[model samples]
Target: MSWTCHLDETDVQEYVGRVLGTGYTVADVTKMHGGAQKVVYKIHCRNGFACVLYVWDLTKNYFQEEIANERVHERSFGGHSFETNNRWLRNHGISTPALYDLHTGQDRYPFDYALVECIEGQKAEAYFKDPDQRVRDEVLERIGSMIERMHANHRQGYGKPDQSGNPRERCHLVQLENAKEQLSYIVLHNGSIRKNHDRLLAVLHELESRIDSRKRYGFIHGELGPDHVLVTDRLEPYLIDIEGAQFFDIEHEHTFLELRFGKHYRYFQQNGLDPNRMLFYRLHHYISLTSGGLKLLHRGFPDQVFASNLADYHARNTLRFMEEWQLDN
Candidate 1:
């Protein structure tokens, strides 16, 4: 439940005044792009301090259920969770945003805001088509190395690192149910309904049989796409938007990155990792992505234009998966 919050300089100055103190004044508060469910702004203070501000939109929640802290309809944990995850990543040698301050709700404003140290860089996707092949290859290798470092950390269970003690059964089961509901909706309405439905179910069953519940899991960004990877002028890659960090099968993480970059799959793969397992997870990921598109279409939560675009994306994934399935068989 989130809504747009249009904040002027006065609004930001007042908010920062309350959080910081009287001496500090906001010089500029510029809204950044690519916040699907939240409003992001780069706040610069007259005192030479700069930070990234995240204002949680209370009209729509990103997680299926409210995360860590929920006060009525307001989401309190959006910032805290990311702050926690960022600390974990930093401790494990991952370059991420550094948290400065987090406010749930104040008398002046009634929403969440987290201020973190801003990393100066353009999105890594900006370099995906560089004319210089050397530059492109170097960036890809660096990205691959960063992912490998993150995957190196092992955990005993499969769940979010921040919520380690809690029973993951609840979260895990909820995901399975959501996936089924979305897949079911597409099967009922789309032209490629029957084949998609059957294939998705078969892939799920295969996943269940192939996965070893006893295997150790590792931390994964869970949402590492080209847009999320930022490259500084120095060629360093910083992963951002890590609010819901979780530990899961490392291979699942690998498959997703492979899907995005396409060329770095072999670079990250270790010896003895079962190819069958990787293929199954890749299939499952595509199915889930397609299902996600269908779910968006049904909800119309993000509006009709966005929903229509997503449904089209699902159509594209459907065709690609069909071709891959044939090669595998």
Candidate 2:
């Protein structure tokens, strides 16, 4: 059974004092929601200072399984990944939260933690609900451009930010194998997935044959969604939750954009993308999400409703996409 590790008053007080120096007393620590892999707290200081604290602990991670070798492209749940990715983005002229201090040792806390600059803004997801169309359009344009900039930064190799040199295998084949593993996991855990397992596998195999080999790769946010973007009062957008940022097939990033951005994805859409890669990546994304959601549910993630809904939504989409693909073919 999994459980969330929350820091007590003393824990927060000492950490804050050490990081922020003297005269910074903790007024309150609000546990932020929507994070499944790590514990995040918005720390408000008695002296009107505010910052965010991130704790990476096994107890906080909802997924219980060991990290698979094929999943090295996307890494998270550690201070090292966060710190490295933060510096990489900043060096590349991308906007990310400034790191105030980072503690990787186990002396202070059993888990790694970091103090970061708290971005004072609403998530780009919130802007979608605005009554003004122009407001929505402008935000979309800025975010779309920011992503384009990130994608334009090319790399010879594909992997996590800290990984150097080329990968041993092609990106698509690696993810295809990972997709099969995810589908198998989903089938075992979800009754709904079990019922349609064969059909899903058939669709995946059909898509696999259409994929073509590619050499060049681009830097991508790995999981760029409006929710991962924070828009300041001045309308500037900053990418957050950036540990997964890496160089990879741009198609993988676009596949996620289409899923997360939904109708607004058109603003960020670009030409010259390979159609075959897009279709293959789309199926893989659905299977991956379904498996991840089920893993969270089985391991007793804190938000039961979110976990259940995530699994159901993606599992249904997997079946729906299969049926749609079959009909089109």
Candidate 3:
């Protein structure tokens, strides 16, 4: 049976009424974009109050069943991870959407859900497209500083915020294993990966050998990009989609910033980053994206073009990185 849960106007209205208290009827409920594992809706009340609702239902999840089941601790999902990471960021002075209410049990609904403050601002990604260069620079600078502040919060061990106990495997080793698994899947599904499988694996192992051990891990929004940031009128940035927040190698986050920000990444660059780790993580990231995009396509994600493009783009990037590594050696 397909697990997709399609919420109608009445369903959203009832949910809004319950969360917002009596007498405030829902004026509108508009579905928002960018949720792959959850459903998001922007709720407008008759009283002019607005908020965002996140519903974590299995029907909306597009991950391969095995991956979804196995990587439960790695990927941020459900109300528990959201609330835990939200509180952690707020406690550390990082800006994130305010959580108004959360329900992890199915007594109220069939799945976990939460109501959060609706940030009124453009996404940082949208702002980066402004014709004004100063506007772009200001946005980049604010994001850079905010990220720096987050990374400054250090931890002795690394893992998701909600994960307990000392990890048995080194962070880099675990990441390498993840990359291998992703690449293995990509090779089976993607023709491009099949052709370049050996070269890509060689590049991954080559970079892996160069990595050195580290004791400190920095707090990071695991999937941070401009789109994940909401900028207010005053130009202050608030992080959204923050369930993946964790203490990990900050280099992993920088690699993603470089990919998402493109030429604008210079503004978000950090000093003292281990070059080897960055290179390794960069390759691993492309592999992960390639695998994830393919999985989404296989699982019938809503945006077929997006899934195909993401998979193709990252697959090409993986090959390109492999060629670059060969030239450098």
| Candidate closest to the true structure, highest TM-score | 3
lDDT (0-100) at residue 276 of candidate 2? 87
Cα lDDT of model 1 by residue, 220-295, tens digit: 8876878888898888999888875667666666777778766645555666555655665666566567666565
**Model 3 pairs in collision:** 3-59
Kindly list the per-residue Cα lDDT of model 3 for residues 92-210, writing each as its tens digit: 88899999889776874678888899999998988867898888888889999989999998877787766662454357887888888888899898887899888888888889888
lDDT of 3: 0.83
Candidate 1 shows a clash count of 9
CA lDDT, every prediction?
A: 0.67, 0.83, 0.83
Angstrom error at residue 52, model 2: 0.6
Give the poorly placed runs of model 3, Cα more than 4 Å off: 1-19, 64-67, 71-73, 162-165
Candidate 2 error regions (>4 Å):
1-11, 66-73
Model 2 lDDT tens row, 122-229: 999898888999999999999998889889987677877678836554677777787888988988878877898888888888898887766678888888888899
